[model samples]
Target: MENLPKSIQVIFDKNPKLSELITNPRLISNSPFIFALSQKLNYSAKGNEDEYFYRIVFKEGSSRELMTINSGELRGLPTTTCIEKGKISDVAGLERVELDNESNLMPVLLGISLYSSIQNSLSYISNLCVDIRNHQILEGQARFERISETIVDIFNSIPDLALDKSLRDAYLSRIVKNNDDCYELYVSQREQLRHSLKGNNPDYNSKYYYENELYLFKDKLLTHPVFSVFERLVAGRICEIILSGNYSKSNIQRHKDFISKAESDINDIMASRISDLDRRISYYKRDIEMDRNLTRDGIEYHNTQIEKIELGISSIKKQIFNLLGVKLSSFDLLSQLMSKDEIDVFLIGGNLIVNDMQLTSDEML
Candidate 1:
């Protein structure tokens, strides 16, 4: 609060409603101001827009807190990301005002809060170590700026699990006895999965959070815990590696190469997936056309079969007429045999023998 200029504080004091906006959803939501603030902190590889949290709070009163996060804008919301509050416009005719100007109340308060939270959270997460068991790791979408705060929050929440530099490094690179390898095996599995799902069915779900909905997917076999110990350990180690300043130019170049290779691998997977999809679509389409052709051919074949059936029936009818004139008792007994399905039974049996011979011939071929 003291860090904020008196001029900004005065505007914030005038607007009590501003501070009330600080809640879990607001803190975690993807907004430009939050994104900018997260950038200011540099805690993780991701940015604030990609990050999410259950909730974040201010120990102080809501008024100052709102002003802090809002930064300089006195009247409405943040102008940094082009989002303004008050549902009003200014002299610019753009329906928004800049916070750098003290006339607006929203920006000034919001900016300060954003900065304060990031700085405090970074210092907080830095002090603690990581804890993991299964060697599983979870990656956040937020850039280093936003993720740093959440990492701190997670560390702050679970103070019991702690690790040092050596342990942290071990956790990141360690291989658990669990059959799944984090880098190679799991990555391959993810690739295989991504490959298997490459259709552009317009009616299919296209939500950005669809992938994150691992919990709702009935086919999904597993989902990462919101803050798994294994994930924490990996993150801690990675943070240490980035902050260490121990890497030479060669090592940094090696890391850059790894990133390039990873991106290339992903692109290759996607390309192959598209090609596979096109091939499958082609095959299915061809089969459909073939079915149409077969149907047209089948009409003629069916007509020919009907003619043969009619001839067979005619022969049976003539034989029955002859039998009616002779041995009527023996014929009545034969009629009671209930052998109407004899032809169908014989056809099924003969087809099985033909199918066996065809299979044997195909195998030999």
Candidate 2:
């Protein structure tokens, strides 16, 4: 309290509750005239912790009433706001003023209220993670349903934090990475299971049971809800950020570079996946042809396995298409010039047509 500026100390002296509630406050902004003060708070609920970020903007002189501005405006600003005296204020207005005797303290109070709201939203997400993990203990369709619900809950929570673009992007990137890691882990486990099953006797009942297990595992892996959800969330966020029209030329260029790199990475990953799927299909086809005593069901199982592998290859191809679409949509002119069908053909044949000229995917990206 003693380290605070005279003006700030005066405000706290006048409003005793300000010092009591604003825990771990740090002076984030200061000027010769002390126009604003920002603080980052650590808020916790139900044993889950989240950051509560807020700022306060002071009026030029004395005898000024409290005012509110949209959270979007708060970005790049020196100060943030909170509520005062148990009153809740809207955090969405561009600029709205309200008369109050303690106008100097109102901005700080508003900042606190905003932080509390953000913390609550984060706590809700933490709860959802816990719920999903518990549900994963269940088997089969029930587990898949629970996981889908949790992902939806996360998507819904995203809009609540839209005001803080950096925070929202960070949270989303973390989720995507975690889900990708989980998908890889699941695939590895399935492969290990497949190898183990191959060591079993090729009797009719045993062969049928092994095939059934592999089919179920492969179906679940290929159709995992997280895969499509990941594509939508990632691509949607990338497009939103690029199209927001808020960034400088240099920042926009940086985003473009990122999109290009992502396209390259996706292409590499898709190629590797397609190759692996093709190898598996070949192996299954060979098993059907070479096994002299293979029953009708055994032959049918191998054929089904080949079909599933082909479907997986198609899914990987679609993923690349989605990523390339995102990259193209980032450019207004390119997006307008190319239709989805044109993009699909471009991806399929590695060639794109624009204004009577054909361009390779590499050149386009």
Candidate 3:
């Protein structure tokens, strides 16, 4: 529990298997048993304002003898406790022995407990978003328009989480897949696509739905690209004209013409570009479909590998904890090993399952 992050501890405390012990049911705020205990014993703080926890010092008259305080009461306690006894595996040769009291002990123990979880929570959320984004994107084959803001926001959060590089790559692909899906969805809505593409044209372009429509829609799609420096500059220029409060018809007309030309140029270029875009989209769809299939397969494969690797890590952690009777981080373990290239390192921890390496391969076979 000391080694686990709060978020992870919360996750586990909610677990049915571990709940009875870690999150044992107790009388909460209104219970008389709580009031009795509060009046009777000293509580070492757990350091969270909303979350309360107090340690019952095992002394002559400590109330823990009568009733053990559960996590419900323990959640709101701060880290200002004066008790001290834990070895600092977090720092090298870090050992402090004193008459254990509230003022010193809480920071050392609670700090490592708290900070570890925060970094882990960020990773957990980032991973979950990546998985959902990937799943949505992979399944999204034909649709290409009306992409939801939520999808975009989650995709954007990948980088903000400071996630490992591999997950970042996974998220980038997911974003592209979603964009492609939206594109497919847009083209499927023929009438709506047609109207949007018509763009205030008094006379509608009554081209063949499947034949010229693909090219035409492609052109229109390119016309409304979300951003470009030139278009931005044009917008800025128009804004400058407006802020000057010159509502002169001539000035307005002049700026309007410039705006019209920019729009026209974008539209014209898109029309020509759409022809190419149609081919590109078709080609991209097939290529992306293949890539999507491969990526999903790759993700599954890597996830399996990651699980295997993490299992080894867990084994390593358990070994260290068992040997030292304290949790040492990966870096700490590596540090203890120093520059040794290959360590036929002994696995020491909670339950060290020793393998009979003495058994020959032939004997095992």
TM per candidate: 0.23, 0.30, 0.19
Best by lDDT: 2
Error of 1 at 180 (Å): 11
For model 2, the stretches where C-alpha displacement exceeds 4 angstroms are 1-83, 86-257, 270-274, 288-297, 319-328, 332-365
What are the runs in model 1 whose C-alpha is more than 4 Å off? Answer: 1-181, 194-240, 275-365
lDDT of 1 by residue, 214-331 (tens): 2222233122222222233233432322323233445444444443454344445434533433443454445555666667556565445445434543443353333221221221
* lDDT (Cα, tens digit) per residue for candidate 3, span 231-291: 2223233223322323355655665555455344444433453444344335444554566
For residue 1, model 2's alpha carbon misses the true position, in angstroms, by 54
Q: Write the per-residue lDDT of candidate 2 for residues 62-112, one digit (tens) a residue.
A: 222344454794644422333445353323222321212223433333322
- Each model's lDDT: 0.31, 0.41, 0.33
Q: What's the CA error at residue 363 for candidate 3, in Å?
A: 74
Number of backbone collisions per candidate: 42, 12, 36
> 122 in model 2: Cα distance from truth in Å?
23
